[model samples]
Target: MMRYSWLLSTVAAALLGSPATADEFGDPEAGAKVYSQCKGCHQVGAGATHRIGPHLNGLFGRPAAGLEDFKYSKSFQRAGASGLEWHAETLDAFLENPRSYASGTRMSYRGLKDETDRKNVIAYLRTFSDDPANIPEADPTATPTDHDIDPVILAIQGDPEYGEYLSSECTTCHQASGGDDGIPSIVYWPEDEFVVAMHAYKNKQRKHPVMQMIAGRLNEEEIAALAAYFKNLDN
Candidate 1:
């Protein structure tokens, strides 16, 4: 009896662990209705063109400010330059709070506070993107790969005093006050995100010339130190 019960539990667990279907994310039809609020500033589907905001076609998998012809805000430009890409996770974060995500953006709408609305809107936008089956790696439906930081690197306890001294080079463009001008603010970022971003730049996964140069010179300890300092800057 115990063996049979264990077998049943294993089968149930396997079923529950199966990958979610695309529809599970949200309903495109419901999303279209929710997207009415965005109609004034944006457009999607065939014949969509730039309105007050950039057209939403091909939004998934696009980098922040990816369109060449359309001019983007300095904050968005900075975000793109820093290797920010538009995936499900990123879009969700941006939709939850637009201004908080990009402080210098021209987007005036407050944000979609409802999680259902955000998911639905994202689903609707996904319909306009390329089919995931064709471009499995780059498509929005594909799961994003997290940066594989070594355990030793992540475990390193940084010296903030050393980081402060090293930060002079960064402060020339990034504000210490967490202000976003033409450049995106680096202060008060979560240490893990900051470290991962820097490593991305260092590894040439992120494409900014200056960032690559700066990050390339820093060792693991230095990177951790910078991460620690910037994360606690507000404190």
Candidate 2:
């Protein structure tokens, strides 16, 4: 049998319908303070070892449950196998709720709900790694300004009912429960903003190839509809 838990996490974002973070993170200094809450279970900075949690050195882009010294929950290891990379957005969602991100994970502390604390903690952790390349240079939340968006094309509002019908394909990766098996949840988003994001994917403004492919097939109306459908979902 596979060493994986078959249990499913909730099909909603960890913050229970809060908007996804598409903005800049908080100060690392502030995060270091917020992380005091985490010190009981985790350790960071120089000579940090495996405490209640694994040392998080060079965590960004590192695969989940990557440490050999610390035994991770089978659920976490399986999640790693499923391609969960610890990028900024991924970290953001997971920090919002660990158990929701990976059901059956052994982590016991409640997730950090403050977006600023989450960003700050991730930023503070970014300082632990020796390699600067492991850290992101610019804020991941900032939308690219290079491309001009079509206001006329975007003017159309989507039909949530039709979008709900079209959303079957989207839920394949985005799991309706907002479970983070390395994918971001679109649940509880602003409809228009969600359309703008999908259009970014369609225009190759966003970098992910899979999203580009998925968004490429959607017309402006379909994108709007799906956005509306998800926007109306209960958190």
Candidate 3:
């Protein structure tokens, strides 16, 4: 009995001192305010419906391109089909550059430059979770793959319905008609070339602070989705 008590006490202590759960990461309050930047297209909170972008409720631990009903870019679908799951690091990287993170994603907001800002945003997202404080720890064994597929090719591989959904954000600034000064008109960019440009922005090899800021947040697949959406634009 004494040995069992000691074992229980040791387990409790270890658990208490153990690192954060997989579901835990960073501050929702700060994330809430920062997320305001995303409100133009995305909707969160209770009973949130899909908007210009799809709903982000319970985004944590969900599939990369998992929103239902709302159309998603082909790139997003491919990523989701590839079995990518949302977590702290994934969200952090994505928040930094949506296009670079996914190759063809159509989200237009530049990523949060500061790491703390990303963490805060994660925190805000956590609030939507049933257990906001404890996020699951990342898989230590996971490593990024070296998929060298062309962005445009991947975009062509994406879904047009999803592309249309993502296009809503782009149309805000990248109108098919003459775009704003400095903002490139995305009416007819080749998918492969667009993917390359977005990657350059992500790596900081490409100039343009705005583009860099936005690109830094994306993944290869997102870049593909955004590229696909623009490639199919009527204008």
Please name the candidate that would achieve the greatest TM-score relative to the true structure: 1
Best-to-worst order by TM-score is 1, 2, 3
TM-score for candidate 3: 0.50
For model 1 the TM-score comes to: 0.57
Which runs in model 3 stand beyond 4 Å of their true positions? 1-25, 135-235
lDDT of 1 by residue, 1-235 (tens): 2223334544564699954446446677888999999999999999999999999998876889999989999878987877777866567667766765665689998888777777788878888988562342434432222335677887888899999988888999988987765667888877876776777678764557898899999999999999889988963
Worst 10 residues of 1 by lDDT: 138-147
Cα-based lDDT for every prediction: 0.75, 0.67, 0.63
Models ranked on lDDT? 1, 2, 3
Q: Report the C-alpha lDDT of model 3 over 16-92, residue by residue, as the tens digit.
A: 99543433335566678888988889888999889889888877667777877889877677666655566555676
Model 2: which residue pairs collide?
11-177, 11-178, 12-177, 12-178
Question: Which candidate's lDDT is highest?
Answer: 1
Poorest stretch of ten by lDDT in candidate 2: 1-10
Model 2 per-residue lDDT tens digits across residues 51-152: 888987777657788888899987678667766666666677567666545655788977887766787887777676554632234223211122334677
